[model samples]
Target: MNNPVMEQSTPRNVSRRGLITGTGSLLGSAALGGRALAATPRHGRAAAPGAAPRDASIADGAQVPALVIGSGYGGCVAALRLAEAGVDVQLVEMGMAWDTPGADGEIFANTTDPDQRSYWLRTRTKQPISNFLGFPIDRDIARYTGILDAEDFSGITVYQGRGVGGGSLVNGGMAVTPRRENFGAILPTVNSAEMYGTYYPRANTALGVAAIDPDWFETTECYQYARVGRRHAQRSGFPFVFVPDVYDWAYMKQEAAGAVPKSALAGEILYGNNHGKKSLQKTYLPRIRATGKVTVSPLHKVTTVRPASGGGYTVTLEQLDTGGATTATKEVTADRVFFAAGSVGTSKLLVALRASGALPRLNEEIGKGWGDNGNVMCGRANHLWDPTGSLQSSIPTAGIDNWAAGGAFAEVAPLPTGIETFASFYLSITRNPHRAEFSWNSGAGRVELNWQTAWKRESIDMAKSIFDKINAKEGTIYRTDLFGTYKIWGDHLTYHPLGGAVLGKATDNYGRLHGHPGLYVIDGALIPGNTSVNPFVTITALAERNIEKIIATDL
Candidate 1:
């Protein structure tokens, strides 16, 4: 879901490929000249053996049967299915391939020690948790195209992954599916029976979703923090559930046993996991490549999609360099286009296109029903006796489920600061009803979100329904040092940005755009806001269902 931070002003007419090449040269020259030495690898992990195969960039004036706008979950699914049906597909990603190692020799940077690879084209890192123990934790880094993108709107910062695999590369790997009873609310137009009976199982199997070894979880040193969280949840009468994840539990066990290089146990979930976690690069992209009918172009951004002079759609693209500069501009024609560039990316592009008259027939619901999935972060200060572990696993395996009773489900997140902080961290997904909209601001020449930060108050209140009671029962207070000076709620950012292009209103039941025959929205933008849990599994399953239908009938 290549979501780059929106620039306030209109972009310069520079080539994206030139910028990337210049940036890469700058980094390479610095490393060779000894001005920028790569940091030593941590956690006993070795450097990446070598670079992986590169995806060919798209040429100007090329024509394709299908153009998938993103390499995220939905785009990958669409490309694979379309290719399997003997259709030639071209997938364009706005970020780097991430197949090559950096100056550090590792494919990704560590969470504790962020480098240039930590953020997307930012001079500094904007960590989700900005503070720790009353001190700011952000640091400066070289400006190159990185993995995570903290895209800022008016009132909120939407965090998205910037590389080929999209959000899967930077996420916590919590592949959660909503409870069957709650499925109706998540996607009311979709058939729940088909989803639960077929698509859900299919998605889960493809994603390698699995539960933790409960017996080992009870006694593992790395999961001691989770155990402490469970004890507090049980004492407070909240249901503590073991959340399944996409991480390879077997590799994690090997990490714990010191038999393999540590990843999850070494706090490696934020930037990108070098091992253990099964990101889309390891899962879907490999299969998509195997089909040989789908060609992917990383660092290629789709800028416009208009009706071609002759037939099909004319797709304009900008080839970006590592430094986020445009090195080349290419125009291609596609018989069909699938918008899967995440919620923010897809919504911004659609709103701009509609307002600019490129796609004038696009419906009025283009940029409506955007949500943050009610994301809020807080920490609980525990007594010294209940130390929440010095060593913690970066992969979250448990959560406090109060969704039905309190409208909040909090994952017992890890605070892997390499020391015992005597605090328990939680990222709660509450049932926040406030949905923002993305609109084309003619004055600014950019898409703006009409989201007031105050809207998060509802989310805060819902989250309080769970933590406030826990605080009362456990006699613990909310930790104010993690967010800011005396600030308890980390409400400024959201990892799960859902909606903007809703299913029924913005698109048909099968994700076909209402007014456009060949355009489709097949990503998180299809889900209207909250999913009552992590949304990736739902997104994948929904895509599975939609693409299957499209292939059977439309294609």
Candidate 2:
């Protein structure tokens, strides 16, 4: 455990280079044994290299009628809709189904005590932001099929999830719809009337969204930090609005009352939530599987894609085992391919495919219009009069809306350490017009993001506009203990990465890639960044609208 004296002594303004390292722990906890889940079956055994494909059914490489490249919100929507319309679909995911139980029978490793199961195919943990202080909190662990992925680009580190549920698995459960008035600018091609009236409600209902009981929120000890944030923001002449989340508020109440073992209470998020949070693994994917027409291929990465000689597309995949070793290579022919592989995933693939000439005429706009969703994270050291609770819930339930003047929507985030640190954290979503481009770097054999460290200054300025006011009103200093001592701003990482293949430009208004009839880009890649809130709801609603169009016209 980190000593209070050491935490206080840790300088708040460490260099970015000095912040990241594989040093010893500042805080530590032993892995708690999780509740055992039933032993669900895996799809198939992995094959050895140069051997037949793992699944005997697809060993001969049959023609797949409809294919979805990810199992996230967009992909699941595509899969379920297509299946309901009687189009046989195969959904490909690059991570585990997360159904298998661990040795201790837990489905996931707790963030506080991560082991091999804390990351996706990495030797050590790579958190989105490096430290709660100058001290190192990330641990060295074996490679395994973990949930969170902190994918590094040159100028930024993108935080995504590596499981059936994708970002839903690792994200805070806040589900926000973009303000109706602000929706037109981000996606001018999209019909706002339809989005607000038809799709957004449809999506929220399907996503199992519910508000925290306000009466309960006011009294709950778990949410005392949120109340503190609300009070602070209100005191600073900001309206603290209640943000809805996908977590079961009633269950959270149970967790708070010691009726259940601590999961969120124990500070377990940004890895995988063992309880409360409703990831796709719990909701959408299960319903898709119930349709009986969807087959998921996990641990398979599509490395190459090309047009088939006759028609449709041919995709080559490298299958992997739990240890990240290649098991076999195979190909599949698909009549239709839906790119639901989140913004970064789909953009990287598309950029590489275009540069490699596999998708020569994809579009001039294919790799354009990517944004970080204007993410800025910072912490304020509150005075003793305003003590943020030691026991905190990882699920954020409130935010400050300074978007009218400051152009920022800041969430009162959680530290969730079960320890009092006298800090108030805020993650601000700002309005940054600086979008990055992804270009294939043949030398590196990867698609490099054109974003630079300098690009974040715009985002920082927008977020600081709001925070500076709050800090001035409250007379509290920014916390140097979180994200590095005195490194108050976490400007290099983004959990909400949006756009690459934008809505109207990269593809048509309905997300169909311009030149390719059956190829579509449907995820966050379709939204040209800045959803004006947490993005999953907009991503879901837009996907709903697009799939409706394709099913009615294109199919």
TM-score of each: 0.91, 0.90
Candidate 1 lDDT over 329-399, as tens digits, reads: 99999999999999999999999999999999999999999999999998776766787776799999889
Candidates in order have lDDT scores of: 0.83, 0.78
Clashing pairs in 2: 12-485, 12-486, 13-485, 13-486, 132-481, 480-485, 480-486
> 1-555, model 2: which lDDT tens digit per residue?
011112122444433322321111133111121123223223335432211122412332868998789878899889988998999988888887666556654667766566777777788777655565455456667777677787888888888888777888888989998888899887898889999999999899888998999999899888889998988888777888998999977778889889987778867787788777877776777677677788888787888778999799998887778888879888989998999889999999999999999988898897789999999898776666676786888889889998877788999998665566666888999988888898888998888988887888988887777677777777655655446644668888898999999988989889999887899988999988788899999999999999999999978
**Model 1: ten consecutive residues of lowest lDDT:** 1-10
Judged by lDDT against the true structure, how good is candidate 2?
A: 0.78
Off by over 4 Å in 2: 1-60
Return the TM-score for candidate 1, rounded to 2 decimals: 0.91
lDDT of 2 at 101: 50
